[model samples]
Target chain A: MFELLGIPPQALFGQVLLGLINGSFYAVLSLGLAVIFGLLNIINFAHGALYMMGAFVSWMLLTYLGIPFWFALVISPLVVGALGMVIERTMLRPLHELDHLYSLLLTFGLTLVITGVFQNFYGVSGKPYPIPAALTGVMNLGFMFLPIYRGFIIVMAVIVCFATWFLIEKTRLGSYLRAATENPEMVSAFGINVPLLVTLTYGFGVALSAFAGVLAAPVYSVNPVMGNDLIIVVFAVIVIGGMGSIMGAIIGGFSLGLVEGLTKVFYPEASTTIIFIIMALVLLFKPSGIFGREV
Target chain B: MTHTIEKSQADTPGPETQAMLEVQGLNGWYGESHVLHDVNLTVNKGEVVTLLGRNGAGKTTTLKAIMGLLKSRSGSIRFNGTELIDLPARDIARLGIGYVPDDRGIFGSLSVLENLLLPPKVADGGFDLPAIYELFPNLEERLDSYGNKLSGGEQQMLSIARILRTGALFVLMDEPTEGLAPVIIHQIGHTVRRLKKAGFTILLVEQNFHFARELADRHYIVQEGKVVDQFRNDEIADNLEKIQGYLGI
Candidate 1:
């Protein structure tokens, strides 16, 4: 029953836990955006749509095939990733020689088409995805009650983010990716199939987003527009973290989520606008972003 | 010199002599601008061939076209008897033709080791790490440094070392001595000669005629993207005045 800042400890801790959960999603989503932008040099406007597809795919698997949540988690990303690869090879590849604006417009249109298809079938209402029985309980952590599923999500997101970072920074394949990101022409001249690399990178990035969606289905309602609106916030996170920066996106996502959570407790009215405000301030002062190199 | 030329001419396993690379009628364009016009050249096995020209003479463009880096190119670029004109840049590289671009093309995000390891070995005879270290000792010292962090000389060395590690039988070096100190240029000259002596064919692009004169077995004087003249290194000594006139410097 103890109180801190004139608020109950339970309420405060609950908000903080919620913040951490949101932070995990932000980190994973923004990481996907950063990875895609790093090599492809295109802001995938369809990222949200892909994320939504992940959740829908999971739901569809569960309903149509009686597949469980755990299996859906494993399979949905691969399905979505393959779809992303197709989009890159068929749609985004031709736009590489053109202006960047065209790709952005194309992906934006793709987002609409995908959302429209889902809405036509499922409508705008949210569908519930029941949590697996193994994760359907809460753990008492002395200070606060933690949902086992939430804790699992936090751990999984952290692991995925760290793994991606390690893959890019430490490994030989990662070195090729980073090098290709800087100069694909040079990388190709070095005998790397850069087009194949591009396709796989875009696919990997989309898979990451879809993985986050799979994780999110149990927490948020599975809706047609779930990813559509969340993507705008993630874009703000990318801008704040510094576009195309891997570590920056991870840090920016978690920190912004915490800030948003704190705002909800202190000033509920400004919770939605806090991230945008910080983005504007960052743009004004450091347009390259917190982790972005000066062009 | 005649012994090496004749040795290359003989196919008795001395060193696989014969023209290793023959580029004929290479014309390149950048969008609508024609950069290379009817460029023709050849490089015998184990020979160092230098393409000497002033700036904007399409020396680099010639290399680009030959390497298949320029897509809007039409020419016969045959390396190791493989037709390279229709292949992609990567395929050309896979054919044991390594390219060290003019800008050095070092990725700033990669470490010295990563840059060296980026190129896949195209053949069995590529230089290993210890061999590369012995050639460019400075690169070994700065293996952990990022590619862009190295000095101009070290970067150039890394670029050359990178291609050499790919086991490329033939290398297209674009201005290996560009933007370096005189001392470093001397070191590069030494390295180029060392590579040649190791049985690698080199097609060098150089504005430094004096440097080229010392290292190359044959010289191709490129002017306005065309091979204006071809002569032996000994002939360069006799035709120095005329060569300088053609080079305009």
Candidate 2:
């Protein structure tokens, strides 16, 4: 059946699978943005820079230190997390009393500086990170060949996203975090150390972005510019999800990712612009977003 | 100044008791606009002092300054014998001074229980959730409801309950009855009486002469960012003319 309307099962299934994988990253990254914004009340424009750092750090470990993929996967997030904490304590803390827009500008400046420094050192060339030896093969189904690495990426993203969700929504520390975000002065009055909570929240958000970078390194070419375009897309996701709620971020990320993937198959030219268009529509129709409460 | 005494009462003791909080030459500014000028005040332990002032009389600014939430140009604020100038708002809060702003800084996104849980346990001790529930039984029914969803009265109760949870020895409440229903105001009055009976010191900022007369053991009339008049509880009946002139009550 060579009918245009009846697209082949293989093409449809492949696009759907691809959508699900892209959705995974969207979920994790947007979740991070939501969590950070809730407590710190600043959009972390440097999140994209941190994600690129994670990929670069992992690549450096492999090329120079001869460290394996497994170690880089685990250690890069911690290294980037430490860096995030330093940025928070030094750059962000001083600007807390000023308008929140200033912090956003500071982070945007940091992103430029980091991206520039990395580009100066590494150049624009995309470096290949070999798929881990164990995950190199493809699994053959009757209809398609599924890459094991791709499958692993989706699974790992889901697990990380769920774990982060559980930590923020279910734990006592998360409860304290929610409380602090609501009314920090009141929280402090109760004898809870609120500054520490804000710092840790910022660090955790950065760590989430770094973790996404490590996951992306082996799947895509490890490049200095990897996060440059992704950050814009993630921002759109956050806008559509609402800045206040964590779960909204995850759901918005994956759903939009899937929509983008589907558009790529049917209308390739619209794929890039679709998320922004969706964001504008959401802003016009439901300003608070799908899950966001009107503040 | 305009003051009203619904019922003439006897004068209480003078300010010679051990002062819990002392402000000397306290001047505050908001972006170059001087709001509190050489404002001096004293609150002894377990005293209910009412600050009477009209809008822009610096009543709210004084409370904010005491909590270290404002920039002090020149002032010495001592809380329980400790120097308070230059302390962060959070640190000042930890010193057992609970501030309830006129806006009633409610964490609208959080639930009633979550709002109660926000304040860190102060030296007086953290909030006993059960005790708060006892004070405002309506809150117990809406424990899981978001703060903004609560009614005006409920939010006021939640604000007070949140501060009480901090176990603060002293409370600075600004217009706690503003925009509240009469019944809610009566309930707050009862709550204040209960709080006073429990030995907590209070500095209340109010425009309502009736409410102030009922709660205040002493009164200070503020105008042009300075204390212009002072009176004992018994003096309220005699000071009605001054209160009306300044406060337009």
Model 2 gets an lDDT of 0.84
lDDT against the true structure, each candidate: 0.89, 0.84
Quote model 2's TM-score. 0.89
| Candidate 1 runs further than 4 Å off | B1-16
Q: Chain B of candidate 1 versus the native chain B: what TM-score?
A: 0.92
Best by TM-score: 1
Query: DockQ of every model listed?
Result: 0.80, 0.33
Candidate 1's iRMSD: 0.6
What is candidate 1's lDDT per residue for B62-115, written digit by digit as tens? 888888889899979888688989999988888888999999999898999999
Candidate with maximal DockQ: 1
> CA shift at B142, candidate 2, in angstroms?
0.9
